[model samples]
Target chain A: MYVAVKGGERAIDNAHAWLAEDRRGDTTVAELSVPQIREQLALAVNRVMAEGSLYDPDLAALAIKQARGDLIEAVFLIRAYRTTLPRFGTSIPVDTARMRVDRRISATFKDLPGGQILGPTFDYTHRLLDFKLAAEGAPLAPTPQAAPDMAPVPHVTALLDRDELIEATPDTGEAPPDLTRQPLELPANRALRLQALARADEGFILSLAYSTQRGYGRTHAFVGELRIGAVAVELEIPELGFAITIGEMTLTECETVNQFKGSRTEPPQFTRGYGLVLGQCERKSIAMSLVDRALRWKELGEDFTGAPAQDEEFVLSHADNVQATGFLEHIKLPHYVDFQAELELVRRLRAEALAQTQPSPRAAAE
Target chain B: MSIMDRQNWMGLLARARPADLAALLPDLPQSQWLRPPEVGAVMVQGRTGGSGAPFHLGEITVTRCSLQLTCGTVGHAHVQGRDRDHAHRAALVDALMQTGAAADLQARILAPLARIETDARAARAGRAQATKVDFFTLVRGEDA
Candidate 1:
């Protein structure tokens, strides 16, 4: 007879202790500092903040270090930390128009007012590995010039707006419903859906956005403009009588001009899909905008083709990696008790089938 | 004055030098703890192009303190990052501002911070403007 296994608690404790040792991994070289992660591995930190939905660089850095550079795990850490926080108040919407832009580019316009300020981008770099980087002191060719004098750049979409060629966005001061406060329901409003997509896993959103390009819910989109920069945040305090700038944060904004089919009620005009994310997350922002446009098919009077991107419920529900990973990885836990019952039933059924196939012993002897 | 203006001045007061507020209200107010000074996080939300639908950007660490003064004025302060003392000071200033003493507080504390914030913003903008570029195209003779 097999007895139920015990002492799992002690084994689990020992395993965790061993995991801590393994995580350090030959500590002779040097230990990673939070500042090093924050400054050096900044892109990772940005992704963690974007998906984790937490903006603090220091905490994101620490989470990255704790998770051993696993971005999804780092995001999970941030999400767990955020759940414990007390919300004091909501800030006034940040003004991106007043953003001190670092990198601004438009696909539609060649000669924009501000011109193209390609701030630190890898768009033109060759992908070959440099052996010199493995050694000390790699030299780089430098380009020098007098700093260009330019004016404040206007958004490319605004040019379209001048001719009334784009969809109108009205300024309604209605407070958007909070996604965190209530359970998610199907057919989520635009605000709630956007909230879900902003923190959605980048890879998942990217794939869905990619599917749209491959004729799944196809909508031809042109990048109207994409900008990355810092914007000041202001908050309203009733006692003070006016809004005040509290701080500044870096953000990535993407606007997509999509070709929309017009109905009898409206003339054919270019529609827009927008994305705004924390830090310089250009890829996520672009993917988010594409998906954002795909989700708006119903509102724009476009027929739903039953595409993955068009299914808001499916996309929002599965976009969170933490929830997905938990459900997926939970199957590894013990299921022996359930299996044992199935084992007995199968054995009995096999024996019965064997008896049915052959005659009884007395009948066979006769 | 309007709540928006009052909030603006209070934000300045909260972020300004603690010494300035300490000098004005040296003694801490005799108030009961409505919500004790605690460090927490708030999920920051952002809107597309500053005017469209809202989305969750991320959460930031914030220290919040709330208290009720003996005279029935309630004050609250929520500041980014974990600074308990700053939150406490801000909360005290908030409660006092609600009372008739707001005018004194604004003139003494808010003015300096407002100037500091404005100057800092202008300096940043100046540095960014130095790198701005303008592009022009040359005319070609064959275009007839």
Candidate 2:
């Protein structure tokens, strides 16, 4: 006998109202404005923009506020909103080589053409909670520094390429598949895999990259270069007979030089794994490069050892935390009918077993 | 001019000093908005390293404005970030530049901005040159 539980509709409505109230908290303190989130909580906005694949700071800030600072949820809001908008035409590739770099470092060389710059980073910051931030005080302004020279800083990989030590990346002229538009298929190409890793959940990618470092996929890597800066984005307007610089964005680009074994036709060479992420997401970008290197095993003629990072289908499918979370949490809803059917089957089986185990009273007398 | 050169000029014009532009044209033609200045985003794409199949890098905020002069020349300006006034001024200049009326003001308005941009670039280059390094290793006796 199964009785369906009723009155969930009203309960849910009340819960939602309570949730709204909770989100408001004490209205005595001033409510957080979108500009404050956009400006003050910039890193959160950056993460949402990066993961959501939309670059609007105001919307991201609003999403952050609506999601109560849960960055993943904020990303989800932005992602949902993005689907409603139409995409304009694609712009020409940004020139990072000409980037007015804020922070640039190369591990392969002790000193490079443009010297290493250690910009604003939390690397050496003490993790102490600042009580001053609790009480409202005007934030201190940053001292301005002179702009970086307008010159192309050669990539560290270019030095290795001179001796044919690194693999050359040639332009294929074919449009790479957009993972957002198409269903992810198995044995995806490099471009598609890169796209997946780009907007893939940062924490998920980090763990996979960490797994590789622990000898799961084991591609020894050196940080060839890590650059954080503003790059110009140019767009072509055929009607205008020229392309124009539309905007600039802050990006973190990481390149990993990994060891590759020689094959029949090719000599042993250091292969490259590239990652370019939005904002100053150093850890995510570095992790993305490691995962990228691990995924290149097939193309580089290395045998797959069934590692998590090496599995294309696994990484690409599970990388989206939104999908993973929804599927994992959906089991909490409505299973009463299913359980009732199982209950009936079990009761019938128990009765049959009891009848078989003990003889009836009439049979025993006979 | 090559597209690259023209782009450079447009960039200069977009960032030109407002006072200088105003001084160049004391009395400007009244222009009506075709598309008023609005903030939006432009998705930025990039190659792996200057040469590879294109990949999505990220998005940057942009303000685009379009205006038409009374003489019917329409011009558009799409500049980076959220400066509505800059976008509008650039659009006006673009409209004026397309018309025959721009002949006298082009040099008067743009030359100073161009010089400033060039000087800024040179100064930046000089500062970076101060940090330029040349690395060399000493050979040990045994190796030699």
Candidate 3:
């Protein structure tokens, strides 16, 4: 019974005009430039890029401006823009092992090679507001140190792999299914699941990951290692007969070691859950790893405890904020005709019920 | 030059700042567009456990173009971001690298860009190096 009604052309236009004015906010103040948003509000840009599944900082900044700082709306804008571009090809999987390590740390091991570098993090910063930053002057510069000729840091999991204490991650040598190109299929492979979780909404995944720690779907996970840095992205050039570096991007990676008992066919070994995300999104990456482990219960021969995180369809279907928001927001649109139909039906049913309960005029006279 | 050498120079050109590349190579040799510079995207992939099966992480903007020099040396360039001029300059550099001008271009263009990249990397390394933890244990009075 859904019927289209058209008449708000002028009203809609006026609304949009007002929205634009409000988005600018207080004409007395200076305007916000795209570069300012890109550089100063970097974490917001990172979140938009990660969730939007597009990594153009400029575009993300522009979206943020247009959306008036509504991050999910910014993500929606980026996603819309991304679908219009022609995809050239897929890049060769980036080598994180050779990444220029900016921040590398391990919670499981006290002493590990490539000793823990904190890099530029807010982990130790006090939560109190800095009123000085509210002023326009530049903040104090960070202390510089002599550059060390550092060796390539190896993955912390390599140590556990040496003695077969941790399960080995063998190269599958297969092209993974592109979730963007295909509809989400249930019983998703690890590769497909990881792809979904990488671009999944940060807040949604964070909560799901948090649930696991609260014993809903406990995996007894430990953060094996977390590293964030720039890595070169290489692509195979068919004419050149070899791969060449196209560019580099900042990536945050987390590997979680989860507890596992020996199954009937396999020996006892620590299981691993992996997460890799665009930019320096450490929180999202760590959360992704935990949720990733919880979802692996079936493959690891663990019990299906009916936890929300363990349900693949449930997690993947609802993880996308853009999709969730669109569906949720559509209800605000005019459902007038549908509601009217329901209203008439209910009234008719009510009258019929009353007629059955009470006698008609002719019956009463008889 | 060997394929390895070509790779090194092409990578440098691809990653160079557009303004930097433009400043270095002001005059370009006559060339015809085999494929005009077009902006597109490349789906970047990452592995499952940093070294396992591959999975799609995200897409990055990449501009690509192909061109042929007057001497019949054809070259292709694919660089990240949506700068058509950057891609064109990169392709020109690629074509020039195969010609008699290869050594001159390397000295004038590639060397400076490489230095800039190296300096940036060093600066980033220095900042991270400052934060490397040096752990120590306190000696107990009784044990001492």
Candidate 4:
């Protein structure tokens, strides 16, 4: 009698203990503290916070450490922890207009209200690797800039709106659809688009944005404004009958203006693309804005040409790295039982074909 | 002082994460309502009659609570067969029935199942370590 091997539980336990040991490494070696990770590896932490959609850099850092420096795994960890958390209430939508702008820039207009603040960017850096920095990178000297004490920078979109050139973004007060609760349908709103871009896989969104530039679904985009800074997250307490500032997050907001050739009915308005993220990730924001525009084909009176870029359902559905990685890696699980059934079916089919070519004694009698 | 670093990535998974599925654009059935089960059960592996080796040969009873929210959100709190905190979970679900809280709960409750599964496996491994044996016997010269 053939017996199935059954030690799944034991095998799992042993593997976990081993993993714990591996995570810690040698017992004699000093343990890495969470603070060390948070401060030293701030950028990694920022990416996790951005992608994980949770603003806690400390948690993100801890997650990164526990994940063995695997960002995707860290994102997964954050996602799981976030589920069990006891949420009191929803906060009001953050106003990027009133954001205490640290870094603000516009590619569309150089001499706009907010001239340009490059903030911290690697755009113009040489591509060559610095081997000296491999040992210990020198501390970057902070660039000092005179504060624009007069007032915060006005939005680049505001400039277009000033002239009635671009379409106005209405705050209809209608709550945006929560993509988490509802399954994504074909036609999505601007809110869903923004959310998708915010939590989208950085690389996937980048590639999608790159595709637009390569004429896949060319939408000439000029970065209207990109701003990064901390914004208060105010939550309403029904008991208190007031909103309280619970926390704050550093966010990156990108608004893009595309060339619009109006259709028969609508005016020739400058189409808009918007992207907002958890941290200072300009590329993610720019890409997000482009994808956001690409997704607006239905709203824009544009034809659905069956192109991959134009397919909102396909793009949004496969936009997450966590979901992508999970599903992609889940294939590695044991499928021997299923394989055995398939093997039996194929054998039966081959046997039947062979019998038909040269009838066996039993078959001939039948 | 929350931070994100490469190390933080792994740490994040050390717990659990389900919100990542937002990328998949999962079609979750809309139902904010919750109903604590009058008589519920979970498929928990019952220990073997003895402690020789805890195999997956048997299963035990685990009663759970279920509550249905007004928005049709179903909240289930399964404990070690019976738990009082099911009400807490139900209340959480009721709260989640609100406009935006549903997203939080889906990530907090459902996504951590994988990590819990991993932890359970680890526990079993800890137990198996004791019973791990290397068997051998001295042979008599008579055979030679």
Candidate 5:
């Protein structure tokens, strides 16, 4: 007997029940509070905020909790919700130069105008596990810092330009490309490059950066400066006819100094790769610089080697994790109808092929 | 194939909402489609026979707007009775579902809209049936 399988209401209900049970886990351990997740797992929240493109910490935290600590899933949740809410209006471009510094450092200079302040970084820590954390409660030392409000951070790049060694950074306030609105076309402006870097995958960005360092498409990068801080996002109310501080966003900015390998006719003008993104994502910024350089191969008079990292269309399109996951997982949906059609066609083709190659039983009598 | 019932239709409609929905408005999706918006006809109740004899439906006029997103999402939005937001929201849901918010969307937006639509439809049917009544009269005897 031929039997056809169809998943009805009962199957769906049971599956959902199983899934909920799986999500909850064994009842022995205490369930994590949303606040606790937000406060403690802050970097995760930051990443979610950056990629989710919404600046709400509480909502991101809630999404993280609902996603069971899957940061990507949390980001997806925020993004989905963010799009649905009517876009009232876009805020004015944030000024990174005026950012209230939290963790600021300059790699190009040992001693600059603004001293390097390593606020809170896991860079120097050993990978050894702490047994105390496993046993539940543990005492932690209070954070140390008088680090009050200070003067504006005169960028490390400015220090280099004081001698007139590089080209002056142009202040073109022209509206940069919105990648969300339009398709990513070749020969992108600086705006498009930065946007791609902001949402790019951590590991993938890191690898492309590593490749550049290894001379696959090297751009001789010395992190001219890396700064992480908070900048106020200002919105101009049409009724009031004046701009006001609506909210602030935590951001990481990176500017890399590359050797001015100029063309035959052109002057030896030094260029820089710059990136700015929501939250403290120095790694992403730096990787962004390398990728940024790779994408600007044509502009920089570098040869097109057809690298995946160098491919503008490929990188910009696939940089989004949410898009990548959805298309990949869509295959899980039932394809039985299509599969059956293919099966019948293939069977018929094979039968015809066999018939052509072999003699029929009645052929000898004929 | 199975019988078309209220429960089956409702189940299909409810899938529009997720169990844990988000609070986002879906934007119009884009596509790489070649076709531009052309004048299309909308289905309307038309009496081929009289209303008493049970007639069929006819077609009305509608305009559809479609565009392809950078992501190659061929979004189609048609105003039923000319409601642009309706088509736009449908296309937006189609785009966002491809993203991470599929679950939240189902719970919040889709579920609520489905519920509202179902309720409104039921209300309309009730109002229509209120006026429906059967009447009869007996003939007078002429012998008197």
Candidate 6:
């Protein structure tokens, strides 16, 4: 049992003041602004927004600044701030089919409709440090091209669907579980699992996905489609009796086709794993898809080979960094009473063991 | 000017930058709040497998308000972010759009905002188009 003792009020206050001072380090230098972080360190802001499960970039940037560049802390700050606000309503599901395509590519097809457009990607860049960037040199502006016709890019998996080569994504028309409002229950549906993976810690999900690639839970996954773009979010107004676009957000979507043989009642077909996340987060979305596929082993009738990724309970329970960090960091708090009790018990047990092992005083004297 | 549907105009208004919308609105009209500008979040949902069942993706901050002009035109606005003034201005525009000022507002406000948005989108699309891969077959002596 933990007991609360309150004597460090002044110390805590002083520490917080010192933390504020340290957070604004080097008074001679100009402090970093939230807008600069939002624009320049965009990927960092994206990660915080995705994991925090909040879509406000300004708030995310402010959290990053207040957290002094610690991303998980920033995410925690956002999550805490999010709970204080009232939920107006839920938006109609965003239509990714109508997304304004920015970067879209497929490994399965060399050339497909809406040819692979590498939008602001660092894929071909060498890992060597650019000293010019470090020296604050402004590079030449990007060369502009004639704008292409705004045609909707069809999914590569849809082509496979035309031939009935891959399993069709079922339109269940079910309302998905809200993981935020309700406690996570085991044996989650595909929608619930996807929602969890979308906001799951990037590093944690990445490692899990990496393990699957390393033969832990091999799925032989292929990147069928990876697209990043902006999509409009719509909400229905009861008074107006129509849905209206409230805002638009950038989303990175990944669909992976995995090899699956026929089951007793099923036929051999390529299965798919999906990942959708807020902002231009390609790596996280890819990682999420791989892990999502691995976790579906049971539903897919594949042997549960006891891989860490296949354990739904284990994966979902520990996937949240906020929960993990809270428990891990709480150990630093005062455990004096518990420690003292353990110390006394340990002393008594050690004394008893020594007394038993050694000769008694009377026996030794005799 | 082509008249826009209620949905289209509302979306354009919501997506417009606060400063841009404010710059366009130089005149004030007498109005009362039916529902004052309030900041809150709306849980955004996404489909499973991109076309499957709907799932809660996350929450986004949105400010919504409803107001009525002295002429009794009621209007509502829901915009992304925590800008109370933006929401108020959008609501006012919604009210004004129903009156005799619809054509004028369309010319002075909505048209320019829509043009700005279109130009921005075209510029982004142009940059992306430049990166489109163009594949060509390499001719060989064996083929020749």
All candidates: DockQ: 0.29, 0.33, 0.79, 0.01, 0.01, 0.72
TM-score of chain A of 1: 0.91
TM-score per candidate, chains pooled: 0.81, 0.82, 0.96, 0.67, 0.67, 0.97
| Model 4 chain B weakest 10-residue run by lDDT | B43-52
| Candidate 3: CAPRI quality band | medium
Residue lDDT tens for model 1, A235-274:
5545535555545678888999999667788788998888
By TM-score, the candidates rank as 6, 3, 2, 1, 5, 4
What tens digits encode model 4's per-residue C-alpha lDDT throughout A27-64?
A: 89778888789898877887787777666666888999
Which ten residues in a row are the worst by lDDT in model 2 chain A?
Answer: A142-151
| Residue B93 Cα positional deviation in candidate 2, in Å, after optimal superposition | 3.5
Model 3 per-residue lDDT tens digits across residues A1-366 = 445678999999999999999999999999999999999999999999999998888899999999999999999999999999999899999999999999999999878988888888999999899888988877688677756645788999988899888998988898899988999998899988999999999999999999999998999989999999989989998877888888888899999999967877878999998989998899999999999999999887899899999999999999999999999999999888888889999999999999999999999999
DockQ, candidate 4, comes to: 0.01
**Residue range with the least summed lDDT across 10 consecutive positions in model 3 chain A:** A142-151
Please list the residue runs of candidate 1 whose C-alpha ends up more than 4 Å from where it truly belongs after superposition: A1-6, A130-153, A172-174, A238-243, A348-366, B1-36, B48-50, B55-57, B66-77, B85-144
What residue runs in model 4 are displaced by over 4 Å at the alpha carbon? A1-5, A25-31, A136-150, A263-267, A358-366, B1-144
Which residue pairs does candidate 3 place in steric collision?
none
Better of 1 and 3 by TM-score: 3
lDDT, candidate 1, at A152: 56
Better-scoring candidate (lDDT), 2 or 5: 2
DockQ of 3: 0.79
Best by DockQ: 3
True lDDT of residue B67, candidate 4: 51
lDDT of each: 0.77, 0.77, 0.91, 0.60, 0.60, 0.90
